[model samples]
Target: MNHQDHQDHQAVGASVDRVAKQVIDAGLKVHRALGPGLLESAYEHCLAHELGLRGLPVRRQVPMPVTYDGMELDAGYRLDLVVINFNARLFRDGVRRFAL
Candidate 1:
């Protein structure tokens, strides 16, 4: 990549890192407030709200499309929460994945 492209990539990476940290911190706050034993949906809702309060745009129950035999289709797969601008997805099991 050219120098400009490399710089752009770095900027995006930094943004992602910031968002990831915020997400993790928000999650910890939620867990500490609510503790364990609640349904996953309850945690998902609380975490999304926490992230939103932190100024991140969050989408819940986002459809995840898949490619099968050269065809893209909605296979009923859904992401628990997605931080739209940051391209970060949080799964039901408390895993975070970035599409960078």
Candidate 2:
């Protein structure tokens, strides 16, 4: 990657971190209000909607693109959520990978 690309990646990473913090905060609110009685899927869906309402850009079910034999192969590896800012300066690539 060139310098410009590196800068872009850095900017994207910052935006991702910011949005990720917001998502975490929203998730905490949900956990507090709803507790652990509900199923994980239900909570996940609700949190996704809630994050969208907060003016955050979210992409769901994004495929993980891989390069194989000089060809781009989109595997079924999907990201549960991707957060990005309007300027594309900051971005969080995926959330599901971090879920424990």
Highest TM-score among the candidates is held by which one? Answer: 1
Query: Local distance difference test, per candidate?
Result: 0.82, 0.72
Relative to the true structure, candidate 2 reaches a TM of 0.59
Q: TM-scores of all models?
A: 0.82, 0.59
Q: What are the per-model C-alpha RMSD values against the true structure?
A: 5.2, 5.2
Give the distance in Å from residue 41's predicted Cα in candidate 1 to where it truly belongs. 0.2
Tens digits of per-residue lDDT, candidate 2, 1-100, equal 9999999889877876777688888888878878998987787777778888998877776676677998878776776766653453323323323352
Candidate 1 structure quality by residue, lDDT tens digits, 1-100: 9999999889987877888989889988999999999999999999999999999989999887787898879989997887855433533333446542
**Colliding residue pairs in candidate 2:** 11-89, 12-91, 15-90, 15-91, 16-90, 16-91, 16-92
Best prediction by lDDT: 1
